[model samples]
Target: MPNTDREVHLRKAVLWLQKKDPTTKKIIQTIGPCTHKMIGNPYYVLIRSVISQQLSVQAARTMENRVKEYYGNGKQFPKPDVLVKLTKPQMRKAGLSFAKIEAVKLISKAYLDGSISDRKLSKLNDQEVLDLLCSIKGVGPWTAEMVLMFSLDRWDHFSYNDLILRKSIENNYGIPMNSKKEILEFTSGYSPYRTIFSWYLWRASVGIENL
Candidate 1:
């Protein structure tokens, strides 16, 4: 959540979106209010997002838990040193694919070399953060965008290429097969709260809580 005045603006954002797009309005009505609790620690957020790629929610959580249990003493995720020390076979034993293991190792190497630090990363703007993180071999725009919203608590960033987000938009608004440029322009009015819009679309994607 934002500060008091920001909350006021967010409520107003809700109303403005309701008036601008019917699909958004219906979703706002049913979903009621944003309950997004920000996750912590940039490093952990990146690791978890990588682990979650192409997996169901439950399966992802299970794999994440396994990682935490083995390397993190069953309390929290391991630190960068622990991640760097774990061999590929050990990471695979934790249920990560070979590719994801490599990804995690690259991330750990970046951390150790001071290429990306929580302190340094926290100060960078969204675009800079995206570029720097994507410089790593395995990280990409989607993962960087997830870090922006989940870890850094940036409100405006959105992942245009996420399949589920695209599917949700199509299902709710009947706007599939549009180019990324058009989709982004269509969402421009959402502005700083695009992440909130994404949360609603994610809910809609599952068909369980959708209107």
Candidate 2:
């Protein structure tokens, strides 16, 4: 089910961003609304983000579809036992890289072993979630951030590690690209609404004027 209550949190963040700076306001005005919230399950979020890493959108989608097909339309994202049932060659036929196959299996193992669960994850704070997620193989800060923002509906998140976001920041601020720390420092003013700003930045990076 959708977390309707999180919408209030996001709305509050939008208000905060409007008050923080004129640039944010301009970006908000340009970008009507953020519509990036498509993920439902944290497991699916992890899987999709992992698949998307360093790959083009079309490639990622193609692979994702293949995996979904392999799992009968991904009714439950394939449990650990289900995943383990498949051979490495079968996973490769589903378009997963050898490394990704291992990574997904590891995540499935974590899930089945009761190391991570939706209920447990719901009780943890953002940093704790990040720490826990990064402990798994093939999952990094960027993928964790996606889960936080899209799946968990966190209002405050901005990935300085995202190159497109960095490019957009440079373009919007008319400044040279700098370190992640510097970018984070510069974006501090838009706290709580950094995710919204990130949406705009990503849009701008893609030459989308409407944002």
Candidate 3:
């Protein structure tokens, strides 16, 4: 459950979205107010996003659990120092691919070197945060966007790099999102509240076939 503050914010965001886009309004009416919680630590969420790339949800969860179990008794996420020490063989044992292991290492290194500072990130705007995260070797715009939306709980974030979102917009809005410009133009109406829009779209995508 969202806290009192988040609940109020969700209400406002939903109302704003309902007025901005008819399709998303229908989704909000069907799903009710957004109840999604942002619970993960910033670095942990980034690492999990890396693990999740190109994998099914179940597979990603399995791999993430394996890493946790190997390093932190399956419950706690490893600290940056511990995670940065992961060897190729150890990561392989935890079901991480070579590329993902590198990404994880680079993310861990950023944390250890103070390149990724939680306090500093908390002060940044959405674009600033994206710029900082995307500066790392393995972090892309998509990963940075996840950090903004999932970890920082930035309500305005909309990632053109997220295929699921593009498809959801296409299916729900009946608009072709073949290009970034089209997606941006369509989503621009929900600015400063696209996170709410995204949460509802994720819900709508669950049972929608052909997505």
**Of the candidates shown, which would achieve the greatest lDDT relative to the real structure?**
1
**Clash pairs detected, candidate 3:** none
Error of 2 at 39 (Å): 1.6
lDDT by residue (tens digit), candidate 3, 1-211: 3588788877887888888756777888987767767758788788888888877667877988988999876887798899888789988999888888898888888888888877778789988998898888778988888888888889887888777788888988877867788889878878888877777777787642211
Instruction: Point out the higher-scoring one by TM-score: 2 or 3.
Output: 3
Candidates in order: C-alpha RMSD to true structure: 2.5, 2.8, 2.9
Which pairs in model 1 have colliding backbones?
none
Tens digits of per-residue lDDT for model 1, 17-116:
6786677888889888766546778898899889988887789889999999988989688999989999888899889998899999999999999999
Ranking by TM-score: 3, 1, 2
- Total backbone clashes of model 1? 0
lDDT tens readout by residue for model 2, 1-211:
3457656666666677677767767877777655556467787888778877877667877888788778744554666678867889999998788888888888888888999876777788999999999999888899889888777867678986677788888878865677666778888867767778787788756644332
Can you give the lDDT of residue 106 in candidate 2? Answer: 84
Best by TM-score: 3
Model 2 scores worst on lDDT over the 10 consecutive residues at 202-211
TM-score against truth, every candidate: 0.90, 0.86, 0.92
Segments of candidate 1 deviating more than 4 angstroms: 1-6, 207-211
Q: Which ten residues in a row have the lowest lDDT in candidate 1?
A: 202-211
* Candidate 3 weakest lDDT stretch, 10 residues: 202-211
